[model samples]
Target: MKKVLFAMALALAQTAWADGGMDILKSQCSSCHNLTGPAPQTLKELWARKGPDLFYAGNKYRKEWLVQWLQNPTRIRPAGEFYEDHIKPGEKHDEIDPATLKPHVSLSKDDAQAVADALMTLKPKSDLIAKEKIEEGTISKSMGEMVFDKFLGCMACHRIEPDYGGLSGPELYTAGDRLQPEYIASYIRSPQAWDPKIWMPNKHVSDMNIQKLVHYLEALSQENKNGK
Candidate 1:
């Protein structure tokens, strides 16, 4: 009983220290990132030099993923940027040096949680563009599939099913269900709007086309049976 109690106390102390670790992140990371809102123009337009938006950090990433990424950010982005190739002749990439990041990344275990807590609270006003359902039909379904696989080339890196594409991007077999139509449209139109440097390709999808594509994506998850 004493041993268990002591372990619990140690765990609590670590969490407290981790929670306070936000200062380190703020000092080192904020220069390249925004906690919320539409991305900055300099970063948004750079195409090559950009960073991930942590506005919806809480919702988008698992805690473990964030910790591991902070410790060592590697090929999380297989492609330099969705539109990196357009800016330069060859792909360019950057990452925090493991040696430098190790010391800088450290936090009083308690501070880590606090930092995560603070970051998790960065919610965007446009959280859900809309909540209503649209008419479902064959055209939307077929076109959505084609758009995902060919038009936008989302299949190039994202795995949709029996093997839609490569393993570079996250699995989107359930994007139709997981993502909101509005969010999808916004992201497709400009991934930088959400994250300065996302791995998805930048085909420069237009707003109207983006909407249509998003409709298709919203229908993919197992949760949305009707996909309306």
Candidate 2:
């Protein structure tokens, strides 16, 4: 009787937590974020999106990172969520229209934790997550930068360091710390798998190259962590 009662109490508590999180998300986050499933199917739909898709947040994010980030929101994409609307051609390169990018709304620590927990429960792309495998590996920063930038041309749109590369894609310097390795690999292998109309191309990168990139991002995160 005691065990049964305790179990029932725990289950009820969990259900309440889930309900609270769902309510918070709907009320505070739904306007900008796509909390429901099915990523943008067409260019028109994609362009209409105001924030990153959270339907597959379980498959994409690191829970702890999400909690921390939600409380202390920072701009992920150098340009706004939709680069096309934010970018303007400059003499040397494309620049972000400062006025187009609005700051993300920050949550209190409790709310951040609740939202992160809720988001981690929304796993829509299990197949992609299941097939991914990453090793505990790393690369030298210089060599990794060479391969990612000079060879792969990733620097053309993604930054490996602060103010060092293009401003279109989400910055890569913090990728390892902010995203799941599996997600990084899966997205690199096929960006279209996650979002059909996302600006990122399906590079169809070789397994070898993908692994190298993952390791490079890990190394970059370590370098940042160590203040180097």
Candidate 3:
């Protein structure tokens, strides 16, 4: 009876620790977050409160940054972009309110580690190819055009000298000239890590798509200079 009881206890304990992510989300975050893609706010068509998308949660954050932000919620944007002003502070751009943002349940160091690991594993839809820079002279002008206009969806968010998508976010017409190829690639892979309150959604394109986009962006750099 004693041995059987011990085994039962061990089984229960393991089950409890199985998915630290589910625990954290259910215990403290599920009220505002969704495990899958963007939160579904199917209520009032005009004014329903939906949470920030955590579909690409893993790609968007550094583990250290995630822990710090979780323990103490801070206002990454002073004016607010998508969500409510849960942790807004004065006129300051970034501020954390410890009292209001305290952990709902105590997270031991191990628990915190487990939670972070689970969160970081969620990536966008993608199959990437890690390769060296394509031959500068290898790409033709027509191929680059297709990449920018169609495959990568660059035209959706940014405008050229003529016109383009919404102006809610930063302009990227001159991206190629202004930014390095690798930096551009990294930014596409994870924009949220750069800023917690990013307005752009992670499109989660494949690695091949990412590389094509980078190459095209670099090509655009030359066009930008000549246009100016």
Candidate 4:
């Protein structure tokens, strides 16, 4: 009887949360994020987008990470989501004015939890991520770094280490800590599947190299945590 009552209570609580979360998303997030997609299909359409599409948030993010990030929002993209909008013509890469950057909207703990619940409901195609699995610590750090920087030329757009790499994409120094392993692998493998107009091109690397890249990111994130 006790177990039955507990289960019933949990169901009711979850339903209440789901409803509240949807309400919050509609009121607060719909303006910036596209909850429904067929992501942008052209460079012009992509540049017009104001934020990254969140239609795949359930597949892309960990629930705990989303909850915490919602409460204490930070910049993920080094350049704005559309680089053309943020980077000026003559300024050097490091010369971006921090003061000019717009901060993400933060939420209270309760609201953040509600919002995360809603975001977590936005799953993309399951098959797109099902095959990706990162066996932690399997790849040597040097090999993974080599694949990321030289073999793939990812460094041309993304920042892997502090004060290093380009600024057009998101900083990857904390990617292992911030992103799901499946998301990292899946996104790298076929970015177009997630966002047709996203700037990240398909590299057609071997699956082994993809696994190495994920491991590398995890190792880098762990090192950063320990160093701090």
Candidate 5:
């Protein structure tokens, strides 16, 4: 009898916690975030997107990273969420105007935890994630970089370091920490499957190259953690 009562109480508490988290998201994050989604179907819808879609957050992100990032938010996309808004034509190349960008709002520790918990519950189309395979073992930094830069031209859009690389895509210096390995491989393999009209091309990278890049990102994250 006591065990039954305790179980019911625990369930009720969890329900309340989930409700609180949803309330916070609806009030504070709904305007800029897509808590639910069918990813944009056209360039127009893609252009209208204000933030990265979170419907598949459970499959795309690591929970610990989400909790920490929510508490201490940082810019993920160098050109801001909407590239068309912040980009400017320069003498040599197009640049993101720093002045036009705004910082993401940070959540309190408790709120971050709650929100992370809620976000992790949203894993629609998880079958897509299930199909991805993460390669094990180490990758040589130089070789991996060669694939990322010269071979694939990834550095053309993504930043490999805080002050390095391009302005059009999400900074990938922290991709290892920010995303699940399978997601990283899957997204790189066919970006269109993830975001239909995204600027990222469908590279159809080979299995060997994908694994190499995943290992590289993991290594990069570790290096950043060590402040190297």
Candidate 6:
């Protein structure tokens, strides 16, 4: 009877926690992020989106990373979420002032935790991520760089090496540290499923290459972490 009663109490506590997290999400995050999504099917719909969808946050973000980022918000995308909207025609990348850009909403630590908890519960399509795992240290830095730049053409929009690559997409040099490996693979395989309106196009990359890319990212992040 004691064991049963304790188990019941624990379950009730978990349920209450989840409910509180959901309430926080509905109240604070629903405006900018799509907590529920089918992803935008067209360019017009994509351009209309104000923020990245969070329907797969559970699958995408590391819990600790999310908590830290929420409390101390920073711009992930250098060219803004919609680059076309922020960059004027003929304006150079250096010309845009970071201070002029709209900042992400910051949260208190407690609220951030609650929001993260809620976001993590929004995972969709478990099968998509079931087989994915990061094969760390499998790819050499030079080889990974080649795949990122030559095969994938990711360098066109993203910065793979801080001072290198395009200014449009988020920097990938830190992606390994910032994102989950499964999230990276899933997002690359089908970006539209995560954010229909995102500017990233589906490249139809092979499964083998996707794993390589993830491996490269993890290696790169490790290098950065070690101050290499």
**Alpha-carbon lDDT, every model:** 0.54, 0.87, 0.54, 0.82, 0.88, 0.79
RMSD of each: 9.3, 1.5, 12.2, 1.9, 1.4, 2.5
lDDT of 6 by residue, 97-125 (tens): 45557988898887788777777887786
Quote each prediction's TM-score.
0.45, 0.94, 0.39, 0.91, 0.94, 0.85
Task: Compute the lDDT for candidate 5.
Answer: 0.88
Ranking by lDDT: 5, 2, 4, 6, 1, 3
How much does candidate 3 score in TM-score? 0.39
Local lDDT at 4 for model 5: 100
Q: lDDT (0-100) at residue 91 of candidate 2?
A: 90
Inter-residue clash pairs, candidate 2 = none
Tens digit of lDDT per residue, candidate 5, span 1-228?
Answer: 999999999999887776788889889988877887888898888888888988788889999999999999889998887887998999998877999998888999988988888887888857878988775689888998999999999998899999799888999989999999989988988888888889998888998998899999999989988999
Poorest lDDT segment (10 consecutive residues) of candidate 5:
14-23
TM-score of 6: 0.85
lDDT of 1 by residue, 1-228 (tens): 999999999988766655555565577667766654455465445453345566676544446545544554433333323333422332453322322222233444444556666565555634443432334433356777787777767776776553345444555655554444555555666665565545566798765566666556555554234442
The TM-score that candidate 1 achieves is 0.45
What lDDT is reached at residue 33 by model 4? 83
Q: What tens-digit string does per-residue lDDT give for candidate 4 at 92-205?
A: 444454555799989999988988888888887667879787775576778877888888899998877776777788888888878889989988988888888677789997
User: What's the distance in Å from true for residue 12, model 4?
Assistant: 1.1
Model 2 residue runs over 4 Å out of place are: 1-4
In model 6, state the lDDT of residue 36: 83
Q: Rank by TM-score, descending?
A: 5, 2, 4, 6, 1, 3
